[model samples]
Target: MNFTPALPKPFTEIWREAYRYNEKDSPRKSSYQAPGKTPVPFILGTTKLTGGFSVDTSEYPTMGYWSNVPRNEKPQTLLVTGYLRGDNYIKERNTLIESLRILTSDEDPGYLELPLWGRFPVIVTNWDVSESGGKNGQCEVSIGLTRTGMPELQRRDTTGVMGLFNKLENTADSLKDAAVLAFESAVDGINAPDTIADSFTQIKTSLLDIAGRIQGSRSSLNEITGGLSSITNLLAQGERNPRKLASALFDSGKQIVDGIIKIRDTFDDPELFFTIKDNVKNMLQQLLGVKNFFLDVDTVTIKQQVIKEEAERLFKITAFSAASQLMTKLEDPTFSQINSYWKLLQDLEGSINMDDTNIYTAVQEIFMTVAEELSSKNIAAELTTFIKTPIPLPFLAQMLSCDEKKLRRLNNFSDSFLVEGEVIYV
Candidate 1:
């Protein structure tokens, strides 16, 4: 039989020496210590894990058991309770306070370091601090941290959408520039007869007013592109949002066409006492046609149509105005005196036509016919004998309602006719 040695009792000299430590040497050390010196266990106070399984239930008489549908796992909550007290309690307490402040801030998904569970991303939902006794600075802290799990990844195709918006903006700018150029060309081509100058001026003023209103609009893109404010209201509606910028461009273009049409219609009366050349009338009609194309056709097609129509319109107006001026010169009695009147009438009747090409050719022929008549007549001798005394030819022509150049040719006057004041016998 063997007998075991008796263990030393409490308060014995050997027990005190084995369990306690001197300032110089120690065999046992505490698990709770100053932070940074050693990692402490969370068990110094309490750590509670709170979570439960989540499921969905529905009543069905056919099945004996309730039908359960699987759902998301319930988030786990970690409740940490601890005390700050020791020789370095003040330092550790301050550090813990600062760390808690950071963890509880607006920063998303704060980090938690659990002694047994490792590190996790969490959100600090609640925190409480208490001092049971006064003046000792020993404090108890309770913190609640909720697990955040993994973050979701987002994917969107924004580049293509942004590119389309940019394209629309560029298209708007180009359309505005084109409209401005067209307007300027139309305005500059208005070589109105003296009888209709007032009416032409009124039309020009109205157009300029519209242009100014567009230029002064509040929207930057609209202002840059001369977009009317009235049309922008459509964009406020969600249904029309997709066409916002394109509609502005369309409206601006339409306004230009409408303005031109209005000018034409205002002077449309048969007995208006003034006449726009057939070509000028046709050009105005075609510009008006641009409104129809813009409204009915797609943007890609409409731009090309507008450009082609504008070029044709400018050409026709310019050519017709020039021809009308020449015709006015030949109508004077001075040039009429040299013509073979019957032959001239027959040639004119044969040349005139509904075809544009034929009409252009006829206009050229008329000019040539007049030139031939003047050259063949050799009226210099008659002109030389007709002038009696020096008189301002322009003033005389103005009084007679005839062209000054025709009067000068009739009296055989020189470029200094303004100073010569040569008068002619009508």
Candidate 2:
């Protein structure tokens, strides 16, 4: 089967248009209506929120054959409600809004009150913006949607994406690890809960290791995703029919969830987990490929082109200037001190090489000598920070440098404290 992912339109073209839009050159300028010639103000309000059902949970043990088994912990609700803003935007901003009464008028009566997608609560009217800053006095109306919508819409979009893959992967990983821990706990006669709790230490380290690997693999996919999020927001801003895009994204999310569910079902068995992991990885690969294809269109071409180009130019200039400054400071005292040891170490390392047999023999002899010296000492034999020196001269030199010779001489200086002792060697 052909495995090629679909590519969006060219990034350069989209970037060019995006650049123009950002310059504020495309939008129609608002008419300067003369004083005292006030247009009809738009009314902004929300529809009455109807009754809705929500799920709640409580812990309970499994019964009958699984009577001793603990209750499984999980999220209480699968879906939430209340987010409709169709009419509220238009009614609040009469100046920018051409179809002010479309959602609430007789032609579209009850549309404002309907739950968006049988879920989101729709706004019944325009927003109250007298509190929002304007040149006109109080009671004067403001036109257009607020800036807040962008972030809110993005939150929903990204949350959906995360829900599809992130939640599934996390849940799958947890279930797999938990099952293994439970089995081990049973074998070792330990409580399942205690084993699970102990497993967290290893689990935390494993997660950190995975995150480190991912960062190394592609230089932080999370950052890449965040940049893509901005592009998605920009697309949403000028979109004439946002619902179409939202629908497409949501459908894609559903497909991801279906794939995850399959993985979940197979997680218990090792062979199956490996198979499912491979398939899930393939899905992610496809998703990333699709995203990259769209990103080029979204970033390099459209209305955002100028911003991208400017940002690139600024970055190059900044990087070159920083490099030049670093070159100027390369010979500074601080740099010299920091790098001097590094060069010495490199030369030291380059000059040192040993044959395998000689290296092993030398290490063994050193260790044997250390053991012999430690055995001869009457002091307690404990491994501590004070490792015994392999060479007697170096040890004596180090001690002398630290004024240890003076301290030893002081200990032997007093005739009364000397106790007429004779010199002895071990």
Per-residue lDDT for 1-426 in model 1, tens only? 111122113232464454345576553321222222232322236768787768755443333444453444677787878777766776766665555565432235555554344345556777776776674757787878776643332112332334333333343343334433443443343332221222222323332343443211133223423434433344333222212333343454444433333433443344432332232233333322222221121223443344334333322332222222222223233333433432433343333221233233333433444344344333432232234455576766676665576565455556555534444544
**TM-scores vs. true structure, each candidate:** 0.25, 0.17
- Could you report the Cα RMSD, in angstroms, for every candidate shown? 33.4, 31.3
Q: In candidate 1, where is summed lDDT lowest over 10 consecutive residues?
A: 1-10
Q: How big is the positional error of residue 248 in model 2, measured in Å on the Cα after superposition?
A: 40
| Residue 227 shift from truth in candidate 2, angstroms | 31
Please identify model 1 stretches exceeding 4 Å from their true place. Answer: 1-43, 61-64, 103-109, 134-137, 152-426
Candidate 2 lDDT: 0.29
Which candidate ranks first by lDDT, i.e. highest?
1
lDDT (10s digit) by residue, model 2, range 234-320: 344543232232222222233333434434443445544434433333332322222111112133233244322322222222122
